[model samples]
Target: MNLFINKCSKLHETQFNLETIHSLYLTREKIYGLNKYIENNIG
Candidate 1:
Protein backbone atom coordinates (compact mmCIF):
# COMPACT_ATOMS: atom_id res chain seq x y z
CA MET A 1 0.00 0.00 0.00
CA ASN A 2 2.79 2.42 0.89
CA LEU A 3 4.73 1.65 -2.26
CA PHE A 4 1.66 2.17 -4.38
CA ILE A 5 1.05 5.58 -2.90
CA ASN A 6 4.68 6.56 -3.43
CA LYS A 7 4.54 5.51 -7.06
CA CYS A 8 1.34 7.43 -7.61
CA SER A 9 2.85 10.59 -6.17
CA LYS A 10 5.89 10.25 -8.33
CA LEU A 11 3.76 9.89 -11.41
CA HIS A 12 1.80 12.97 -10.47
CA GLU A 13 4.99 14.97 -10.07
CA THR A 14 6.21 13.92 -13.48
CA GLN A 15 2.89 14.83 -15.06
CA PHE A 16 2.98 18.26 -13.39
CA ASN A 17 6.44 18.89 -14.72
CA LEU A 18 5.35 18.03 -18.23
CA GLU A 19 2.41 20.44 -17.96
CA THR A 20 4.70 23.22 -16.76
CA ILE A 21 7.12 22.66 -19.58
CA HIS A 22 4.33 22.47 -22.15
CA SER A 23 2.88 25.79 -21.04
CA LEU A 24 6.25 27.44 -21.21
CA TYR A 25 6.77 26.07 -24.69
CA LEU A 26 3.35 27.30 -25.80
CA THR A 27 4.02 30.76 -24.40
CA ARG A 28 7.30 30.96 -26.24
CA GLU A 29 5.71 29.91 -29.49
CA LYS A 30 3.00 32.50 -29.06
CA ILE A 31 5.56 35.23 -28.50
CA TYR A 32 7.55 34.07 -31.47
CA GLY A 33 4.49 34.09 -33.69
CA LEU A 34 3.52 37.56 -32.53
CA ASN A 35 6.97 38.85 -33.26
CA LYS A 36 6.78 37.45 -36.74
CA TYR A 37 3.40 39.00 -37.32
CA ILE A 38 4.60 42.41 -36.17
CA GLU A 39 7.68 42.30 -38.31
CA ASN A 40 5.82 41.26 -41.40
CA ASN A 41 3.01 43.76 -41.01
CA ILE A 42 5.06 46.76 -39.91
CA GLY A 43 8.02 46.32 -42.19
Candidate 2:
Protein backbone atom coordinates (compact mmCIF):
# COMPACT_ATOMS: atom_id res chain seq x y z
CA MET A 1 0.00 0.00 0.00
CA ASN A 2 2.73 2.44 0.88
CA LEU A 3 4.74 1.51 -2.17
CA PHE A 4 1.77 2.00 -4.43
CA ILE A 5 1.09 5.43 -3.04
CA ASN A 6 4.69 6.43 -3.50
CA LYS A 7 4.71 5.30 -7.08
CA CYS A 8 1.50 7.15 -7.82
CA SER A 9 2.89 10.33 -6.33
CA LYS A 10 5.99 10.11 -8.45
CA LEU A 11 3.97 9.55 -11.59
CA HIS A 12 1.78 12.50 -10.83
CA GLU A 13 4.78 14.74 -10.35
CA THR A 14 6.27 13.61 -13.64
CA GLN A 15 3.01 14.23 -15.46
CA PHE A 16 2.77 17.73 -14.00
CA ASN A 17 6.29 18.55 -15.12
CA LEU A 18 5.64 17.30 -18.64
CA GLU A 19 2.45 19.31 -18.93
CA THR A 20 4.17 22.47 -17.72
CA ILE A 21 7.00 22.08 -20.24
CA HIS A 22 4.55 21.47 -23.07
CA SER A 23 2.55 24.57 -22.18
CA LEU A 24 5.67 26.71 -22.07
CA TYR A 25 6.77 25.44 -25.45
CA LEU A 26 3.39 26.18 -26.97
CA THR A 27 3.38 29.70 -25.51
CA ARG A 28 6.83 30.39 -26.89
CA GLU A 29 5.77 29.24 -30.34
CA LYS A 30 2.74 31.51 -30.29
CA ILE A 31 4.83 34.49 -29.22
CA TYR A 32 7.37 33.81 -31.92
CA GLY A 33 4.72 33.62 -34.59
CA LEU A 34 3.07 36.81 -33.43
CA ASN A 35 6.38 38.65 -33.42
CA LYS A 36 7.11 37.55 -36.94
CA TYR A 37 3.72 38.71 -38.15
CA ILE A 38 4.18 42.10 -36.56
CA GLU A 39 7.65 42.54 -38.02
CA ASN A 40 6.46 41.61 -41.48
CA ASN A 41 3.57 44.03 -41.39
CA ILE A 42 5.50 46.92 -39.85
CA GLY A 43 8.56 46.68 -42.07
Candidate 3:
Protein backbone atom coordinates (compact mmCIF):
# COMPACT_ATOMS: atom_id res chain seq x y z
CA MET A 1 0.00 0.00 0.00
CA ASN A 2 2.71 2.43 1.00
CA LEU A 3 4.81 1.38 -1.94
CA PHE A 4 1.96 1.88 -4.38
CA ILE A 5 1.31 5.33 -2.91
CA ASN A 6 4.95 6.20 -3.28
CA LYS A 7 4.89 5.18 -6.93
CA CYS A 8 1.69 7.12 -7.52
CA SER A 9 3.23 10.15 -5.83
CA LYS A 10 5.92 10.15 -8.45
CA LEU A 11 3.36 9.94 -11.24
CA HIS A 12 1.30 12.64 -9.56
CA GLU A 13 4.24 14.96 -9.76
CA THR A 14 5.36 14.12 -13.27
CA GLN A 15 2.60 12.70 -15.47
CA PHE A 16 -0.57 13.84 -13.75
CA ASN A 17 -1.61 16.15 -10.93
CA LEU A 18 -2.60 14.94 -7.48
CA GLU A 19 -6.22 15.96 -7.90
CA THR A 20 -6.65 13.90 -11.07
CA ILE A 21 -4.98 10.86 -9.60
CA HIS A 22 -6.93 11.14 -6.37
CA SER A 23 -10.26 11.39 -8.17
CA LEU A 24 -9.43 8.35 -10.25
CA TYR A 25 -8.36 6.46 -7.16
CA LEU A 26 -11.60 7.34 -5.44
CA THR A 27 -13.68 6.17 -8.39
CA ARG A 28 -11.77 2.90 -8.58
CA GLU A 29 -12.12 2.31 -4.85
CA LYS A 30 -15.83 2.95 -5.03
CA ILE A 31 -16.27 0.40 -7.80
CA TYR A 32 -14.13 -2.11 -5.95
CA GLY A 33 -16.14 -1.59 -2.79
CA LEU A 34 -19.39 -2.09 -4.67
CA ASN A 35 -18.11 -5.33 -6.12
CA LYS A 36 -17.21 -6.62 -2.68
CA TYR A 37 -20.57 -5.63 -1.29
CA ILE A 38 -22.40 -7.47 -4.04
CA GLU A 39 -20.23 -10.51 -3.63
CA ASN A 40 -20.87 -10.68 0.12
CA ASN A 41 -24.59 -10.05 -0.13
CA ILE A 42 -25.56 -11.95 -3.27
CA GLY A 43 -22.75 -14.18 -4.40
- State which candidate has the highest lDDT: 1
Quote the positional error of residue 8 for candidate 3 in Å: 22
lDDT of each: 0.99, 0.98, 0.91
User: 1 or 2, which is superior by lDDT?
Assistant: 1
Task: Judging by TM-score against the true structure, name the best candidate.
Answer: 2
Ranking by lDDT: 1, 2, 3
Q: Per-residue alpha-carbon lDDT of model 2 for 1-43, expressed as tens digits?
A: 9999999999999999999999999999999999999999995
Clashing pairs in 2: none
Q: For model 3, what is the error of residue 42's alpha carbon versus the real structure, in angstroms, after optimal superposition?
A: 0.7
Per-residue lDDT of 43 in model 1: 66
Candidate 3 local accuracy as lDDT? 0.91
Give the TM-score comparing model 3 with the true structure, all chains together.
0.59
Superposition TM-score, candidate 2 onto the true structure? 0.92
Q: How close is candidate 1 to the true structure, as a TM-score?
A: 0.90
Residue 17 displacement in candidate 1 (angstroms): 0.4
Poorly placed runs, candidate 2 (over 4 Å): none
The reply for model 3, stretches above 4 Å from the true place, is: 1-16
Off by over 4 Å in 1: none
